[model samples]
Target chain A: MRDRIIEIIGTHGKNQGALIPVLKAVQRMNPRQYIPQEASQLVARIMGLRESEVYEVVSFYGEFSETPRAEHVIKICDSTVCRVNHHRELVDILEHTLGIRVGEASRDGKFFLEYSPCFGACDVAPALRIDDKVYGNLDRDKLEAILEAYRR
Target chain B: MKKNVALITENFHHYIPPDLAGYKHFGGFTALKKALALSEEDLIERIEDSGLRGRGGAAYPTGKKMRQSKAYQDDIKYLICNADEGEPGTFKDRDLLEQDPFGVLEGMVITAYAVGATHGILYLREEYAHLLELLQGAMAAMRREGLLGQGILGTALDFDMTIFSGAGAYICGEGTSLIESMEGRPGRPRNKPPYTKAQGLYLKPTLVSNVETFSAITAIVKHPQGVFTGYGTQKSPGTKLISLCGNVNNPGTYEVPFGLTLEEIITELGHGVAGDKGIKFVQVGGISGPLLPRACLKMPLTYEDFDAEGLSIGSGAVLVVDEDTDILDFLDAVAAFFKHESCGKCTPCREGNRQLMNILKRMREGTALPSDPENIQRIAHTMKYASFCGLGKTAPTALLSAIKYCPEEIFMRRGQ
Candidate 1:
């Protein structure tokens, strides 16, 4: 993870304008990992700065998570396209079953739910993400049935 | 779309012809010829007489802006075409730029002529990098055809336009902030009174019109009586270009006459909600317009209609929500956006929007105490009234409107 962060940051680090995208690439070094404490430290070290300095950039952005997500990550798309389709039923079922709400990992630590805006898929209304996978045209029963397998 | 027909989209309003041939077909730029024959004052009066309002959220009349812009005594005045449409759900301007670049260019050129501008600047959003190339192409074509630069269309209007891209700051959509950004300042907004029309870009009097507002000028200029007579009520005349996204059958931009009801527009043009979906809420006008509950969906999409509903039409950005979405989560995400976008220039927005996210995040996590909902309302209400700039002032409008109509939906379990 440390070497990968250096490589990504080192490759495009000279361009100040590339900061946002570079930081994003560094953040995604561990795809399944959420916000790790050392991630900021590593970012600071890679960028030749203090840990608190890198932490500022991480905390500033809404997309960067501070911790690792659950085994199954579910982001319901509330973007312009998805809103037209309606994902409330699926969100509700996930909330009820996982015993967690949006932007959170379940108490059992198996699933995470978050809201995302505009995934550029207005054609298929009501979109969702499981781990990194996107699903569309969801119904509540199917959402629960899909989640049952992720639980184990 | 009409027994009274309308064409407002790339799908519908496509292949618009240009030049004398195209102009005659669509009745183009006749207003310019007439206005040129008359005086600038007469041109301004023609527009004010038509009762055309600004499409960029302020609802200020366009003719008034032109008159005020004309009042400035700068040797070099400017017409800044605000294509940096940073609003989240709004794409009406994008469509206008894509489908009818000439019409949009003509509006800016004529507007510059009226305002006595020699140079024009289009502050386009960086995301639409392709549009930068498109607009430049159009300008090059205009210049080659002698429609741009000195003595345009054989008139004294010597106007040339250049395009500039914004570096990912949403607050730059505010006219003042846009000027500041162009002057190479950080995109944080400034207080008004030294309004943009009076002392804008580089301390010269400037006129900033939304891309959609500029496009509407062509239609108005084409037919003087058509401007006043054809569409909308007397107060708010002319058609609106709506950016319709989400679960509609035809999810695209539609240019329709004003005063159409939400139900009428959604049902006829939006093709109604898919499946058995009943709309839970509609966030009218991008991020700032009120979050209209399902009940108000029947209201007309006019200025008066939203005014009656205690909402504003904002900039024709309609985000449709169906029965099953989580309102709390939606608020959380919105609050988070405002918080993230806060330029840190003022406390009401900087601190206020940040706190909004906290309360929302808490509510989402079930850590919010009993009085949390009330506190949430209090902060939002304060932000609405007290904030310094448009960013802080309208920051909480979506949340506030959401809470007003869907009082329980803001809190989980409470709404249930």
Candidate 2:
């Protein structure tokens, strides 16, 4: 797994500009979908960036998770547009169904729910992104069915 | 009456993005070909005469920017499309990238030609990672059609672009910070003396404009200045793409001419506020923009009018609020957003946003200080005058404007 991760990082090249892209590539390689401390150290050593610098890149961006993440990450839009369009209700539904509040992973490691400010998809208000795919104009049943697919 | 200029949003509402064939069919690269025929000076003059301004909220005249870059003598010049659409409510750029990728590329092509830039970079936000493949495909198609590679369209000029996805940072949308991030550092806004136009992107002359600005450039280059300037008002001579959201019935990207009144925008294009509720206020631009109460609805949505009213048409993101909404809650969200997104390089912005967020949190819990509002204004004033960049300077706008216009909601509010 480490070899494969390093191989993926190599594909991004060893330039300072490759730091963000390399980190993203490493995280995607991890099944837990996060840049583990060891991975960060490896990236730091290989890319000639300090460990502290690598960690700074990791923590500065909201997308980079320090700890292990669940199989699927669900990001609920928390901007004013989503808020006015009952985004709170969507949060409540996800929390109730997944048994975890915002920013927490479900106990079984099925989902991680977090509030993202805006996905730039306010055209269809009340949106959420489960992994890479964005599902907009969400209702309770639609949300339930979408989660069910990921669960299975 | 609402007038629409469909240049930026030509391929919207379509199932698939406009591929090279589709883009060519709709007169896509006509601008680049036409621009190639004209001398570089004339090309820049056309843009200057067209009265196109930066659509990335600053509204600086595009012609002046191109001419400035052209004046600089450098072996290597750069043109960057600021597609890092991280503004809280602004999604018009996203629409441009998703729908008409080639139009934006063509704009950058013309810009590079006029500025004598050989390299271009599209600084896209990482959250829109899905669009990377789509853009790469478009670029590949352009290469195959001889539109993007060396000596594009059989000319001596050489220019091409590659996408640089920004790691998640709202401050990166700022041009200096974006250039810093591109150079492989934490995204922090640099102090201005050597402004980006003069010394930018590895200490060379660079031209950075928003995605929508580039799309408008494509249109201006394709047609005559009279044709491009025919739609909008005299001063603000071009249509603006507004990302209308929040308490609006028709919430989507709408392109309207500059003279449209805010009331007409909310009613005619927006289809009025959602649920037929009375409007409490509307926020023009994004989170960092001025908030106007219902009384100012008749104000024309122009840079001049908004500027007179102590507002800006920054990013053209109009977020409407209804009567039932609590202004305090909105302020809390705005404060929190600035707090989270502040680059923390300068003390005034970093500490000021943290302090503002803390006070708003206290207000949410009914434990705020009596002097909290005054403190917020003071911090806001200090940050406005002292902070390093636009992020800190404009961070306090929503709260300060709320205090000025809708004090009844913010001041009298109690427990959650």
Error of 2 at A35 (Å): 0.5
C-alpha positional error of residue B199 in candidate 1 after TM-score superposition, expressed in Å: 1.2
TM-scores of chain A across the candidates, in order, are 0.71, 0.95
The local distance difference test score of each candidate is 0.71, 0.86
User: lDDT per residue, candidate 2, A1-152, as tens digits?
Assistant: 66875796678888888888888888877777788999989888888889998898889887889998888889898887788788989998999999898988999887988888677888888999887788898999999999899878
Classify candidate 1 by CAPRI docking class: incorrect
Worst 10 residues of 1 chain B by lDDT: B3-12
Docking class of 2: medium
Q: In model 2, which residue pairs have backbone atoms overlapping below 3 Å?
A: none
lDDT (10s digit) by residue, model 2, range B9-102: 7656543664687777778788998999999999999999999999999999999989988998788788899998988888999988988888
Q: For model 2, what is the C-alpha lDDT against the true structure? A: 0.86
Model 1 alpha-carbon drift over 4 Å, by segment: A1-152, B1-31, B412-416
Best by lDDT: 2
